[model samples]
Target: MKATVSWQQALTFSGKTESGFSQTLDGNGETLSPMETVLLAVGACSSIDVVDILKKRRLTIHDCQCELEADRAEEPPRVFTKIHAHYIVSGDNLKEKDVDRAVSLSAEKYCSVMLMLKGNVVITTSYTIVD
Candidate 1:
């Protein structure tokens, strides 16, 4: 839960996590901006929940991908106003109902990032299963 950000030069920084992971962040479009990182965090967090939930349901999952589209406010803060998560799931004997339930559960109950932004962000989800 602990991390540090160091100035790298000219609107760029290096972030190191407690787990020894690091990433480069830049505001000059050389790397992912702070806003882009937030979008990525939400997508990755929810996708992890979806994958875990499906696995717990005994579903045979071969691959899972989540595509996220977000709209930000026009003001200076530019907070996310809306987000849509489109999940592409590939597996054998994948039930549509299971996928639906997994995504619903992740958004409503499991994904912390999604829950944190629930009140302010309009979040929607959909899925396609490839057999």
Candidate 2:
């Protein structure tokens, strides 16, 4: 519930929770940025539900990866304009209907981050089923 960010260097930091788990955050232009990390939080938050919903339906999951893209506003203070998450799911005998339903349920009903991003950012998704 509580956390802190300690400075590491220019555009880099380490954020740690009260429980002590920590992650290195950096504007390295390759992996982590502040805005990119926000999108990651949103993606990871929803991905949990997506996988859980699919698993409860008895779907076999080989792999699941979410690719998040965002359009940021051009202004003195930038903000997100739109966001999209493409879920690439690899599995044997996966059903498109199930994947669609799971995604829909997460965005519309289950995922809180998705709800928060509504209006400010247009959120959308597409799925690829890999056999």
- List the candidates' TM-scores in order: 0.97, 0.87
Tens-digit lDDT string for candidate 2 (23-62): 8888776447778878998789888888999999888898
Per-residue accuracy of model 1 over 61-103 as CA lDDT, tens digit each: 9989999999999997889999999999998899999999999
Tell me how many clashing residue pairs each candidate has: 0, 0
The Cα error of candidate 1 at residue 109, in Å, is 0.4
Best by lDDT: 1
* Model 1 lDDT at residue 9: 100
Count clashing residue pairs in model 1: 0
Model 2 alpha-carbon miss at residue 85, Å: 0.6
Over the full model, what C-alpha lDDT does candidate 1 score relative to the true structure? 0.94
Using TM-score as the measure, which candidate wins?
Answer: 1
Looking at model 1, report the run of 10 residues with the lowest lDDT sum: 34-43
Candidate 2 weakest ten by summed lDDT: 27-36
